[model samples]
Target chain A: METPCLVMDADLMEANLHTLQAAVNRAGKALRPHAKSHRCSRIAHRQVQVGAVGICVAKLREAEVLALSGITDILLTGPVADSTRLQRVPALLERAPHLMLVLDSHETARILHQSLAAHNRSLDILIDLDVGLHRTGIPPCDAVSFARALAAFPTLRLRGIQAYAGQVQHIRAFEERRTASLTCMKEAGQTFESLRRQYPACTIFTGGGTGTFDIDIEIPALTDLQAGSYALMDADYRTVQSRGCLTPTHTFTPPLRLLTTVIGTHHPSHVTVDAGLKTMYRDGASPVPAEPEWSHLSYEWFGDEYGRLLTPPGTRRPRCGDRISLYVSHCDPTVNLFDAFNMIRAGSPAETWPIDLRGCSQ
Target chain B: METPCLVMDADLMEANLHTLQAAVNRAGKALRPHAKSHRCSRIAHRQVQVGAVGICVAKLREAEVLALSGITDILLTGPVADSTRLQRVPALLERAPHLMLVLDSHETARILHQSLAAHNRSLDILIDLDVGLHRTGIPPCDAVSFARALAAFPTLRLRGIQAYAGQVQHIRAFEERRTASLTCMKEAGQTFESLRRQYPACTIFTGGGTGTFDIDIEIPALTDLQAGSYALMDADYRTVQSRGCLTPTHTFTPPLRLLTTVIGTHHPSHVTVDAGLKTMYRDGASPVPAEPEWSHLSYEWFGDEYGRLLTPPGTRRPRCGDRISLYVSHCDPTVNLFDAFNMIRAGSPAETWPIDLRGCSQ
Candidate 1:
């Protein structure tokens, strides 16, 4: 394989898929893996084949790509307000009839309804409730009023609610993560209950990530889980302990690894690799070398296309032309940087999956 | 304009081009604007038209894109070592006769030469020297020896030296930045002086960025500048004081702004904008609202698709659907996230420029 290649361990990936699917299944909740992580249609198909209710996407562009790839049931997790973007909904709905969108504001709901009414098409939507992460969504306190106001938009059907506690996804301790997740999902559950009273048909209450997968299942209202990152875990999630395990063991192995060649070895105490800030997303924890022997060495950002592996005393210094595998800090944005993922089955090349939904953050 | 749109102010961009080109012209040095910042062939062509000798790219993929777009003279600034990538040189050279590549290691030079020799093609090469940034380059002490070793490869023609001090590019104080840049460039100049003895054709001593454009020109051995971010100034560079002025001010105006819409207004003390970590690059500094009136509001990352504007006491919160323009923290990676630049000329829509080399980080 070429340098700076994104490789996925197929065997490990398959194991991770089954592990997460079984966990969600045992909890009696649907698994809707977020496509934002891998952005590959092949992976989405695999997730669906292994019993996924549907796939969740943060952008309409992702939903459109996955829908065109024959994904019947698709849900857009983020709020879509712009008229230009909302106009793209009907075409997407035509491709994926079970397409669902999340709406947090009345103005957005009204505009989306108006856009849908023009085509005489009605769409299913989830009221995005802000549990704790104040990025988007209606506050849990206003969920009842917001769901009631949705009566004005007859073209938009109130399906359920989406309250993803993104901020609580990476809490290190299992207990702390469960407590934080329960606090947020409890409020979301109450809001869903209130909405279910008025609209008894509202059954889908989805929102949970890889960190709080087990804890979120405890909430009686959360019917489906939006757990991304479990399929191809990253360095950031490796620290989080297993939810239902007796010991502090990671449930999912990091399948995604960036293969970067050492381009420069001029620095006396370090070697420069091709993967840097541009190659691996550094929005969260710093990326580490995948090899256990290189654990002692620390990674540093050299530039956009270069990173440095600091070689302390007694550490083996990597030479020029040496290829190093790296566990990315964040998977979503790092996967977005690549064109395709080189699938490795049993440590050998299998097939390549194009990250078709990449750069789909529209 | 649509939400989360990348807009380029044409007038301001033109002014920035002329200002930097005129500065380099006055300095008696060539300006080879780094295309890695904009990654648009149109912008690269404009820079060349404005007196830039050619363009500098950080990756071979970028070079291929620019060469395909009819850019003749192109210099790839980063080191290319992998055999697979080295095999691509001859084809690129066919498109661009004056294409130059930077090499820091003899192993890379040997491999690159072997690839070029098989195709019976010779390439113009620059000995990349590591002045301070421990990225990709040979140490100044090993430059002459490394350049001498290149004599073993007849297919590679030694042209000049490339010593980019990316570490000194963002120093806030002009004096401190000048001192740091000079310390690095002077060493590079000395190395160039030693190499010129054996290779008389080694004239191009290109290495300088937007931060140290003025100070680097003070070094007589420095032949050209590799300033990339000057064209589209970012929030990080805006903090840098001007070089040769009595008054402290930013020489180039930030022409690039990310236009985003307020997607949610559910948070009592804040409004959520559509642009987030996936939209803006937060590697160096935080992106600020482009509008001066909303300068008091602070921006926070919401998630992949949203950001929160902290609305404190007495500050008015933006409503849903309202557009908020943001000044990106870093221009290069941020530009890589977008597909096109919505060109705005005199406050009116002009044309769109495709970020053709956007994801060319291989």
Candidate 2:
């Protein structure tokens, strides 16, 4: 369990967490998952023990590492706009009492209601709108005045409407990621129907990802999908294209990878390896070799701790110390360049996990 | 010190660590300074207190986080081939007895002489050759039979060459980065004159970086340099071009940047911010706005934690929460995507540091 590390495959990630929680509970929605893709509080408590009704996290340091690992329904999804992380969102709502927070602006809902109204606490939020990913939301023509200025922040509680469209999550075309996930579910179902008729505490709309999780579970105004990289499939989401009813292909099974070794060969066709771009996360591509006998190789970036590969001429290469594996190309910044996650199973390793919100990216 | 952190100007990083340690001690070389580019053990003990004769790590978990921060002369520079990192290199050479490692295989010098002959210790090594960045190294006709099979590894001591032309460190033309750093200092000066005529305890030939630290201090068989991003200049080494006698354009002074904020504006021009590609390191390109009043803006990546910017239409946008400052495009895998660093100085945030071998990237 070493070579450049990060393994996982524990029975193919518990069969990709029981096939994306039985296809987001057969599309009636509510899976949550996305703990910023395996920042591992034991894979967000095994995605809330396979049902996953809560865990999104984009950062309040991944909702304080999945709320100090107890994992009470998290949500975050970006937008905290720093008052040193909105004063740690009322101490991450005292370790995740269903903490929500997505905000888009009445100056970050008055700096998160003056840091949760000086901790008398009342947080929940959501409002982030702009479905097209202008990178941070608020603009379904100003989601009803930013959910009526985050319902005048008496410790902020609007509780719904995020609209994620992270640039159509790698749209390599399956009807253009289902027409851009139905145009971000028709503008987040018109800003969750005008903030559930002027805010009856807007009932949780959330967002979608893992390449529009089967067109955001057929979008009936997304009650909650937030999809984090379908239990670690990568190589840029295994080249997208999973069409309509979701099984035209890739029902997801990459189960992370990486391993590595082969620390240098280079003569009649390069080799190197020991991972790179600092243990693989070069944004959109390059990290393949899960051995199809080195499928004519390819890789490249050889600096932040080497990578190379190339190997064209006769094809098979790979010698120095050999090992290999690979896959990655972006599984949440390659699981935030690892601090743990070995796992494996019917082939070795077993348990390691620890990414505990890796570098948390504060 | 929050809005997307990673600051570090502290008097332009103590004047870029005393101008690259007085230009590698007026070209007679020996500076070392890499610590995998600011994996900060308090910036490698402030680059070994301004002169830097130690530190250049690439992994054994960044030489066990710079030998548990006392940093007793590191070196590492990749190629360990993991038997769980060659059994932690004789317990990191008992906390770095001037560590040094870099091999180029005899199966990694018999897995570091059977893990330092089962800890009876004795390490120092090197060999690693092939300078033109054929990643990892070896080929100078197999460096004298790989330093004569690492001198029959009686606990291994060779210690001479290491080559490292990391693809000629971002060559944006200064006589094509001095003819590719003088063709990697003429094949590492003919393999350091044939391994100093067969290892006369091969006195440290090392390599160079921070774009061939002024063409490897005019290469006379480089006795050390190893320049890690000249104390943090970025935006792709500020597009290189520093000519022969150096300093015609950028003689290092970027001193890291990132700050962030303006969390989404998008109106007449766009803005976003909250850093991106998981806080800047999009392998060689994106990050920019270190304000010339937003110098026609630009940036882009907008996803793994935002970024966008673009503001051209009559410029000057950055509205939302304001704060600005970007710069980055590569400062060692964006200082391994942050866990600390702040530092600043006259503009604020006086001292945070902590990137202590960030995710050590084993």
Candidate 3:
């Protein structure tokens, strides 16, 4: 395998999948693993085989890729606001008929309705409610009003609501993360209950993430969970101890590993590796070396094409040709940087899975 | 144009090209623009047309794309350390006869030489010297020793040395940046002088970037300047006042504009856009709205697929369907995210240039 590539331990990933799926199943709620984390359609298939109801994607392009891969049940979690992107909706619907979309603004819904109505089609859409994240979606107070507005569009079907509290996914403290996520979901659930009273087809209350999955599954309103990073964990999630309070402690181990080669070891304090901000993204916490022997060293961004590991006292410094496996800081953006992941099964090469939906931000 | 896509003003970019090329020409040094900033082959061809002798790339994959596009004199600026990547040298050489690679370690050089020896071919290599970056490259004191070691290999030819002062590129103050860059280059020049006497083939002393190109050209030993970002300036470069000290204050105008659509206007304090960390990379400075009328708002990363512009007091808020043009925070990583550049010429669509070398980090 080449340096600066993603390597996934398939056995560990399979174990992670079963653990998360079993937990969600035990709670009697559906699991729609977010495909935006791992853009590969193969993984989405595996998720479906492991009892995932459907998959969620962040963009229309991601939906197009997954839909082409024959996964019909896909919910696009983000809004398609512009006309250019709205043009792609009909073609994707032709492939995956069960596709659902989220709508935060009436302006976007109106444009999408116009586009879909031209093709003599109707799309199932969920009212995206702002659960304190405020990034997208309508305010929770205006859910009924937004749904009433959507009633005017004949080409759009009213589904349930999607209220993902993305802001609480990385909270370090367990009680705080629980309280924050529950408070937001509780308010969103109240709005969903009111919307459910009005719309008969509005049954799917999909939301929650890996961080508060245990707490969120207890919510009677949340019919399905859209947790992504649980399938292939990263270093960023390990900081949240609350996520590990399940039956088996720390059930989700990081299956996704970043394999990088050391290029220069001349510097006494640090060794430069082939992976940098370009190979692995720089949004989240710094990546940690996967091996226990090199735990003393810390990763730092050198440039676009190089990263350096600071060698603490008594740390074993890596040589030029030596390879270092690292747990990626963040999974989603880092996955977007690579073309494919080298799948390893039982410490051997299994297959290479293409990141099919990479650069699907459109 | 689509939302969250890169748009380059061709005329402004052409002016930036002419201004920098003229400066380097007057200094009697070759201008080898780095292709990593703008991975499009069309832009590389444009840079060559504007008097660039060759182009520099950070990865072997980037070189492959540019070489396939008929760019012959390409320099792979970063080291290709492992055997898997070294095996590609012969094939690249077949396309680009003058393709040069950087070498920082004897382990990588031996592996590369062995690979080339198998193909019965020789390669041009530049010894990378550490200029206080401590990322890649050998120490300046070990340049001659490294050169002597290279003489032991038959498949590798000693072309020159490369010393890039990446640390001083973003220094806000002009005098501080100038002093730091000159100090590093002077030390590197002394090393080059010693190595030049030992190896007569060592003529091309290529280094420097858009940040230190002006200061580095003053060093008589620096035969070529490998500046990249001047062609399409970003919000990060605008902070470096020294880069603007050339003829006609602020000679390089930011031709690259990130076009995004307002997705949600439900929040009272801010409006959300369709560009986030995934659309525009979150390294370096925050992107500013291109229009002067909305200058009061500042950008904040909302999530992976959305960004928020906080509407301050007396600020005119954008509607749901309004378009926003922003100066990207960073150019290289942001360019890698997009597949094409929506070229704008004379307030009209000129062409769509594919970012052919995107996701070529390997």
DockQ (C-alpha based) per candidate is: 0.67, 0.24, 0.73
Give the Cα error of residue A207 in candidate 1, in Å. 1.4
Query: How would you encode candidate 3's per-residue C-alpha lDDT over B164-210 as one tens digit per residue?
Result: 99999888777788899999899899988988888899998999988
Q: What is the lDDT of residue B132 in candidate 1?
A: 81
Stretch of 10 with least lDDT, candidate 3 chain B: B242-251
How high is the lDDT of residue A274 in model 2? 76
Q: Residue by residue across A218-261, what tens digits does model 2's lDDT show? A: 87877877787888878877877787544324788787888887
RMSD of 3: 2.3
Evaluate model 2 with DockQ and give the value: 0.24
TM-score of each model's chain B: 0.96, 0.39, 0.96
The TM-score measured for candidate 3 stands at 0.95
Question: How many clashes in each structure?
Answer: 0, 0, 0
Please rank every candidate by DockQ, starting with the best: 3, 1, 2
Report the C-alpha lDDT of model 3 over A271-305, residue by residue, as the tens digit. 88989888888876789999898888899888888
Scored by lDDT, the top model is 3
Interface RMSD of the candidates, in order: 1.6, 9.0, 1.3
Tell me the lDDT of model 1 at A126: 94
Residue A297 displacement in candidate 1 (angstroms): 2.5
Query: Which parts of model 3 have CA positions greater than 4 angstroms off?
Result: A114-118, A243-249, B243-249
- Per-residue lDDT tens digits for candidate 1, residues A291-340, read 98778878888777778899997778887778889889888888888789
How far off is residue A94 in model 3, in Å?
2.7
TM per candidate: 0.96, 0.38, 0.95
Residue B94 miss distance in model 3 (angstroms) = 1.9
